[model samples]
Target: MMLDRVLRIVAAALIVGGTLTAHKSSAQDGAKIAAGEVVYNTYCATCHGDGLVSSGQTFDLRRLEAGARSRFENSVLGGKGQMPPWKGVLTSEEIDQLWHYIRDNAYQK
Candidate 1:
């Protein structure tokens, strides 16, 4: 009873730890965020709106919540709020690269 519970707790910890480790490693190897600056400047700057600082209701990309990364990416690719979707405009790889850029420069602390 007690031993079984302890074993289960240890197993869960190992699984969770392993998952976290893998995710961190993968995120670290994601695309070069600096390269994203040029891309953002070209396609995203006007509305987003100035220097990662917006003049409108555009959410500040430099100050994203850690968990909001996916939702932000979804909104970018599929559109949300006041912004139009870029689903067909940009490839999935571009979207992913943008995510890495934002995640590294803003979200992850």
Candidate 2:
């Protein structure tokens, strides 16, 4: 009976640890998202629209799905359609932050 109780406690601890690790891995850090938001407002909002809302004049950033990260990076860095390349204008870190901000506002999320 003592062994059974110990096993149950150990199992519970493992489950809780697994749950915490999963949550930490799945959720984007809030600080990174906030920093991304600042970068977006300063550099992207002019065309992407404020708060990621588009006026239908440009691509709606919120429409991008979770799997669109690579496309996002490519487009921003190389430019797409009428958008200008931001490769020289923004650092990779700033671009990553912008991605986080856009991800946070994504419709699928």
Candidate 3:
């Protein structure tokens, strides 16, 4: 009985660990990043730089952490520092995709 219980616990732990790993792996995608690049080129290229390397004020978004997504989204939508607000210009989903793209590729590494 103890053996069965141990096996069950191990199996459960493995399942949970696998699920978390999959979620982390699929959290970002290239297509979404491409779309975000388009959105950025169309809207934010002038100041932020199409290369995502402009070294002015405002935190470089490429290295933003997952925990900062909400605050960053609000900041992007509401405008902060020298960056303009984009609440009306872009949908929330699009903003998220852009953020994910930036997080995944834009000077982050």
Candidate 4:
């Protein structure tokens, strides 16, 4: 029936749309993470170490889990322990990119 055919076409279109959206999101995340890496190397490598690898003297960035975004942002913005605050130095978008970079290289992920 024409109704059945139309329903099948609608379902397929929905599935394809969802897939494309997910793919686009993933690609955007990858781009953000790459940009974040550049920012990290410029600003954080001195203390955080290269490629998120710490030398035991500093906190290992890779140890941060996925659910730690809020904590991460808070610490970076307000400063944590000995770490200096980056609130004035970095924009929110830059911070978000840094988070994506960190999350991408997380040990657990």
Candidate 5:
């Protein structure tokens, strides 16, 4: 009887803890996405267009699927077609943030 009560209480606590953890994780992700937007606007907005909207000349960033992270990285680092390389210009963390921002606004998700 006592053991059953304790188990129920423990289960409830675990559920509450998990909920809080999920909320915290979501908040952190939101912050990262926001940071990525800043990086995108500063560096990529010129060719990529404002808020990932392309003007039919450059590639539409939103068209990139979720599994295209490696492709995106390669293009950004090496430059594709007329796009210039960003190898030494942007940090890896900034790239990651840009990915997050782009992914958050991606068509797949």
Candidate 6:
């Protein structure tokens, strides 16, 4: 009887812990997305369009696939076509935040 009771309690605790961890992770993602939006508006909105909506002149960021992180990073850092290199202009953290924001709005996801 006692073993069963202890097991139940442990299982409940594990479930609660997992729930809390997921909530924390979601909150962190939200913050990063928000920060990334700010960065995008400041630097990329002119060419990329507001909210990742392309004006047909530049690439549509929303078309980026879920696995396109490396492609996005390379393009941003090395510059693609008319785009200038942002290697020294944007920080790594900003890049990561931008990725998170873009992924959150990607067509695949």
Which of the predicted structures, 1 or 2, would earn the higher TM-score when compared with the native? 2
Candidate 4: global Cα-lDDT?
A: 0.94
Models 1 onward score TM values of 0.61, 0.81, 0.65, 0.92, 0.94, 0.97
Better of 1 and 4 by lDDT: 4
How much lDDT does each candidate structure score? Answer: 0.75, 0.88, 0.78, 0.94, 0.93, 0.93
The residue ranges of model 1 lying beyond 4 angstroms of the native Cα positions read 1-31
Clashes of 2: 0
Candidate 3 structure quality by residue, lDDT tens digits, 1-109: 9999999999999999999988876755666777888887888777777567668654666667767788888888999877889989999778867886777764433
Per-residue lDDT for 26 in model 1? Answer: 73
Tell me the deviation in Å of residue 98 in model 5. 0.4
Model 6 steric clash pairs? none
Residue 26 error for model 4, in Å? 0.8
Residue-wise C-alpha lDDT for candidate 5, range 12-96, written one tens digit per residue? 9999999999999999889989999999999999988998999898899998888999999999999999999999998999899
Q: Candidate 1 or 6, higher TM-score?
A: 6
The candidate maximizing TM-score is 6
lDDT of 4 by residue, 21-101 (tens): 999999999999999999999889999998889989998999999999899999999998999999999999999999999
For candidate 5, report its TM-score: 0.94
Candidate 5: segments with Cα more than 4 A from true spot: none
- Ranking of candidates on TM-score, top first: 6, 5, 4, 2, 3, 1
Question: Which portions of model 2 show Cα errors greater than 4 Å?
Answer: 22-28
Worst 10 residues of 4 by lDDT: 50-59
Residues forming the 10-long window of minimal summed lDDT in candidate 5: 57-66
Residue-pair clashes per prediction, in order, are: 0, 0, 0, 0, 0, 0
What are the per-residue Cα lDDT tens digits for candidate 2 across 1-109?
A: 9999999999999999999988886565666799899999988889888898898999999998989889999999999999999899989988888888888888889
Q: Name the runs in model 6 displaced over 4 angstroms.
A: none
